[model samples]
Target: MSLKLGIHTGPQDLSMEELLRVWRRADEAGFHWASVWDHFYANPLNLREDPCFEGVASMAALAGATSNMRVGCLVFCALFRNPSLLAKAAVTIDHLSGGRAEIGIGAGWFEEEFREFGYDFPPLGQRFEQLEETLQIVRSLWRDPVTNFEGKYYRLPGAVGSPKPLNPNMRLWVGGNGPRRTPRLAAQYADGYNVPYQPPEVIRERLDALEQACERLGRDPAEIGTSVNLRFHMRAHAGDSDADPPDNYVPGSITGTAQQAIDRIGEYVETGVGGLNIAFRPPINWDAYEAFIEDVLPVFHTASA
Candidate 1:
């Protein structure tokens, strides 16, 4: 499939109604999907970020608001909830949105959120172990008749499903960057992989690793979706700053000119990205929304390998 373009929204905002306007505008702009961040506190992207709203709540609200839009979390913090319960919650949202939900999840990182919220922030290895179990349990729970799972981290006794996915299998997207475990989990359960704001070179390495994992597992890497989360826009000096992004941000994250920005995305596409999720932090900077919607996005859509 050719590349698709989408944007991210912060859940640490005022209310769903407030963010709903952004979603409606994105929908009106002819975008394919709307992704919201699932951070409990302000994330690394925020220059001086603060946690605003809850992730799943905004997801449920977004699912209810838009009819044509496909809504999902950019990457949910998976450590806070039980896998079976999280699966049920996703299933409920899927039913509410009439099957428009896609589960976007990751092994939780943000240490601040865990310490502040009183959740265990385990060592990296243990977290990956939990994430693996979570993905497995979610897949099992989505079965037509329901199933059982007894893993080191999760134990569901003949768990009955909540709302069976309308799509024979609910779409799963695992997000992260563990050279070994992450891609293996993706190969086993993910319909797609959601990568964070890593540089193209790093992204290429990660993709290679995933391909290796897929090969080991007898999976065709091409069959699994690959989506990159472009950290920030590169419109110009005076572009949107709804988000005060960081400097170490990747090349795609807020440094290039319009043409350069387009070129960078093209490079990523060439490197095997199936879709691009460009970040549009607002306050509407020097860059005009008209120019972006009218000029830039169209160029991205028509861009070919």
Candidate 2:
């Protein structure tokens, strides 16, 4: 399979105009996908004063700004919105992007955001239950003419979702770093599975688990796409030895020279992921990003071709 390259930008610590510029640049540079993240607060939770845009609105802006690449949010927190509302929003975004919108959902983790925002921060198990219920409701709403779901957390009775997605096969993704339940959930419900900020070994293990889950469920493993998200911190030039990634940099980050970035991406391809998204946080290294668009992307695109 051809490996797709993408950019995953968190909608925090950046202006709307800057975000749109990045998205438009990725689109023009032939990226296959572009995605935003969902969070009520800027991650690492350093301060409450940080500027963070909401996910759904940012996604709508992304759809309006980009013409080529697919637009999506990496994962919308299931606890924040009703399933019916999310489903309708996804369909509307699909229409806005002319059938280039995908959606991902997950059990949320930001407890501070939940509590501070007046949302009940349930235990992990309960959150997972809610997430599963949300998945079922969203699928039914998108596929079935009328959705009627009776779950412990949510009840949808005879809900009709009009103006179905512009793309009949618009993908729904399940994203997390969990090993067992996440894979099982993806096998049962999602069209795609995504793991973020994970090393190659961990990603391979997760993918293997997903395959096993698919086998146990008697479903085709190939039916669900797999992807990994890595932190991007590329150096501007090949000789910039001192310009290393931060000491506290997360695992699976792409750093160093253009050639090194290419090789690291190759390792992910070997893990059997169909796509890789480099997560961009501010202040973005524009020079490194341009070098990636100019030097690194072509190598993979040409090889895939």
Candidate 3:
């Protein structure tokens, strides 16, 4: 399948009405997917540190608001909630959206959220251990009639979650850049692998690693999909030159005019990325989103066609 695009609004700064507007607009514009992040605090520093809505609740709202676009959290922290409960929540959202919900999970990062919320900010290895267990439990809870899991970090004894997902084939996206454990987890338990803010070259290397991990598991590399999420900046002026991208540009950012953005996306496609999830640092750039959909997205659709 050709590449698809997703929008990440990140549940920050925007009021509830504005958030709803953005998701509805993306859905109406025929974007393939939309996501909000799982965070207790606003991510961008400039935003007035106001009330940030919880991730899953925001996704539930998005699912209720949009009919066509798939909506979910982008890489919810495993440490934030009980794994089985998380799975149940996803199933509920899926039913709400008529099977348009997905889950993107990762080992918890962002120490600030952890400490403030009183979640255990365990060591890296322990966190990965929890994440692996979480993935396994979530998959089992979604698929099995009665799930039983025993792990160091989490345990399930004769656990059964009813109202299985509306879509039996719901997707689980794994997000992380762990050179070893992350890719292996994606190979073993995920439908999709996603990396945030990594440039095309960095993404290519991760994809290579994932392929190798898949091969080791005797799984076809094609079985797993890959996507990159990055901060995006579109140079708005028509007179903007197609000059070389700045050397000091942020690591996982795409910044350029329409054609330049297209070329950058093309580089990612050439590297075998199956989707691109675009996020903007606040103040939210609705114009860039609209302009890209108008001017750049069609070029990709045409090329793929």
Kindly list the per-residue Cα lDDT of model 1 for residues 105-217, writing each as its tens digit.
79888887788778888998898888888888888888747677878887888888866877665678998766677888898888888787777887888899899999998
lDDT of 3 by residue, 44-142 (tens): 433435768898899899999999987888889899989988999999999999999998999977887788778878899999999999999999999
Q: TM-score-based ranking, best first?
A: 2, 3, 1
Global lDDT of each candidate: 0.73, 0.90, 0.83
Q: Model 3: residues >4 Å from true position, as ranges? A: 44-48, 239-249, 302-305
lDDT of 2 by residue, 44-116 (tens): 7778999999999999999999998888999999999998899999999999999999999999999999999
Worst 10 residues of 2 by lDDT: 296-305
Q: How many pairs of residues collide in model 3?
A: 1
The top-ranked prediction according to TM-score is: 2
Model 3: weakest 10-residue lDDT segment is 240-249
* Highest-lDDT candidate: 2
RMSD of 1: 3.5
Pairs that collide, model 3: 197-252
Residue 173 of model 3 has an lDDT of 88
